[model samples]
Target: MAPQKAAQEFVGHKLLDREGNNVGRIEQIYFDDRTDKPTWVSVQTGMLGRRHSLVPLQGARVNEGDLMVPFDKERIKDAPDLDVDRHLSVEEENRLYRHYGVQVPGPRRGMQDQGDAQGRHAAGAAEETGMAGRATGEHGTDTRAANARAMNAEAADARTAEADTRSGRGRADAMADEDITMVRSEEQAHVGVESRESGRAHVRKSVDTEHFEQDVPVSHEEIHVERVPLTDEDRATAGNAQIGEEDEEIILHAERAVVAKETKPVEKVRISKEKVTDVQHVEGELRKEHVEVDREADHLTEDDYRGRRRPPAG
Candidate 1:
């Protein structure tokens, strides 16, 4: 496809180099004055896309909806820097052609030839008019002088118009060069939560010992002898018994305390985790960009121009 058509189709799309590396995005396209074909293009580059670079459109192609040029990223970045004010001067265009080692188009040379031809034609017409005036004598001489004056006036008017056009173009160029852009940026605070091992807890069991005490009652047998009161009954009961040397025996018993141990579960115990949310007040020093404009005029102070306006007191 033609370079001009390709440029129109893929404008605002990514520009890739021959090695498949991204150069930038195509922002603007330029065309040749005589041929009306795409000659150069401006690509937006740099960190913030604040910078633009010009690259030649020769040997350019479109692939996969992107404009690809036969140049590397470094070569395009290091190309000549020129003003992109909707037109390119002959000198500026020639410089680019030379830098890229491309042959200058033949149409520009044809334009120079056409100009020389016009100049020669005008010179020949003047010579023929002078010869005609000489042949007609004084009458033709006055006519010739009048014609010369008219031609001179026309030429002067043309020069004045040309100068005015050039002056306006100069002012426009100055304005284009003076255009500046400032970008203001600031830091933002982004807070997030992360899980870490702050501390730990454990549930365990251990055995312990204690002492107990209590009181109890007991009974035992006792023997006693009396003299006068039981004499007749005791004597009668003892008369049936024979006196003998014999031993008496008896059994005695008492209560005692006993202790034993048994195992049983009193309560269930286990480890668990839960989330508790709370807000924390965080503070830090943030850096930011502030823009100040300075204007030079006949009667205005820096404070008056740069400072904020305040309301008057009542």
Candidate 2:
């Protein structure tokens, strides 16, 4: 049998999961009718002890000054909800035991039974709750601690097996005496996003000569002397007019290319994002575990696993 602790020794003790995650704290303790020892604890689970749950106190320990449970948080959160304010019936107790997979204490043919006080663990959570806890069992005890340690180890092993199964890495070696080593490989893919200028263009100017020819009529001064029969009017003007003592000059004009500079928008390349769906052909070698049975191993009768050797989980 495990050591017994006073009802006050349990109140306000922090409850921790196997992975050291805080589930809650003990708000009350429920004693067994026959043993008069704490059989169940009312755990105030949510923030500030707002929610309550009843957990079996069997095989539990104040290991290293903390109450470490064998199960995880999700399991405790999903346990059957029981109100600690009301009486805990024999039916309720049996259900709790079954839910926790605990073998209910069998009937002792000649054991004495005690009457329960109010049959509940707590009156109200807000009631004053903590006390200085001292060990109640025999001092210098080792058997119960060893049993609890074994139970904890079994529970941890079961959890690890379950996790391995879920992660698709079932145990390579299941035999107790067999040595095994598992090698696993994983591939990581990284994708990134950013905006940058792939190419750039701007309005720029540079001068270059080209053969640009066009039919353009231009006027220029040219010296031309033509002899023609004098008309009556030209003769009369030449005879009446005197020779002018002045210099004669002519001006020449020709077409030339003229350049001008101005700014104007001709085309635009607006930047925007469009979500496009495309398949990326990522190639890599994947590894899978291949179970191979040794062909040359000698066959021998193995011990039958009775499943009773595992200690009761806390």
Candidate 3:
């Protein structure tokens, strides 16, 4: 039995599923009316935070610190899904005991036999409201903390198993005898501690997060300029044009060469030496005149004698 004040604190307190690891938190406690003691606890499980189940608190042990729960995380996870109402029922409690393979110590009896305030059956009004918020039994045991721990452990274990399976490995090596070191954040731990409270448990805690900043090189490749070949028509036209130009140039050069070869320049010729000849004239006229005069001398001598006679007379 918890202390009175502690009991008040623990009324909304949690119970965890550590043995048959299941993710859940304690909703409320279902006490046995016959013994005026708490029996099984109702736990809400699953991701949506729905699906309430009842787990027998028989062999379920609590830790000294009222913090951690020691149990086989995996087994609890695989346990049967519990209905909220039936688990609170006597018959439902029997079914869970049988399913879990646990022995029920108490004799089989109906809830109505128990006395007032401690009856197995709740008040008529509580009964009418259905199982939504049925408060039965004297000690209101809050299993919220225990349930949170169990659920957390179950979730952690499941994640670990999944990770292990993904890595193609078997069950994880045992972390510690009390708590399996699957993984849990300090915030989660805080939440687990306060999950039993009526309000939300918002405990400030620090976590070591490995942040990665990597520089991935993005390379831009050099693009080359492509040169497309000329078409057939263009090639033919260019070839013809080149050939015509080359032929014209060749003909022009040939004509210029022939003209240059045919042209001749005049050159002066030099004479080496010249010779001069002189002719002599002979005088033989006096002899011929004297001969010619001899004939006439006779006639002249008569004429001269007549003239000399005339000059002598003058």
Query: What stretches of model 1 exceed 4 Å from their correct place?
Result: 3-6, 107-314
**Lowest lDDT 10-residue stretch of candidate 3:** 185-194
Q: List the residue pairs that clash in candidate 2.
A: none
What is the C-alpha local distance difference test score of each model? 0.77, 0.65, 0.50
Per-residue C-alpha lDDT of model 2 across residues 199-295, encoded as one tens digit per residue: 6556566868676555655555567879889899889887877777988877666665555668687896666656566665656554455666687
Candidate 3's residue-wise lDDT over 1-314, tens digit each?
33333323333445554543444555666666566565666555544554455566665555542312333434444355655554355666677777666787666565334454464334643444333223222236535444545655686699799887866543333323345334332211111112233444344647586755655544444545699889998887877553333332222211111112353647855544443445545343221112122334354577787777785444
How close to the true structure is residue 23 of candidate 1, measured as C-alpha lDDT? Answer: 86
Alpha-carbon deviation at 47 in model 1, angstroms = 2.9
| RMSD over all Cα atoms, model 3 | 76.6
| TM-score per candidate | 0.38, 0.33, 0.30
lDDT of 3 at 36: 53
| Residue-pair clash count for candidate 2 | 0
lDDT value, residue 161 of candidate 3: 90
lDDT of 1 by residue, 124-223 (tens): 7688668656755867457666676577678779989999999999999988898778999875545555466989876777878877777756555555
Please give the lDDT score at residue 154 for candidate 3.
86
The runs of at least 3 residues in candidate 3 whose Cα sits more than 4 Å from the true structure, single-residue gaps closed, are 2-8, 11-14, 18-22, 64-71, 74-82, 85-87, 110-314
> Whose lDDT is higher: candidate 1's or candidate 3's?
1
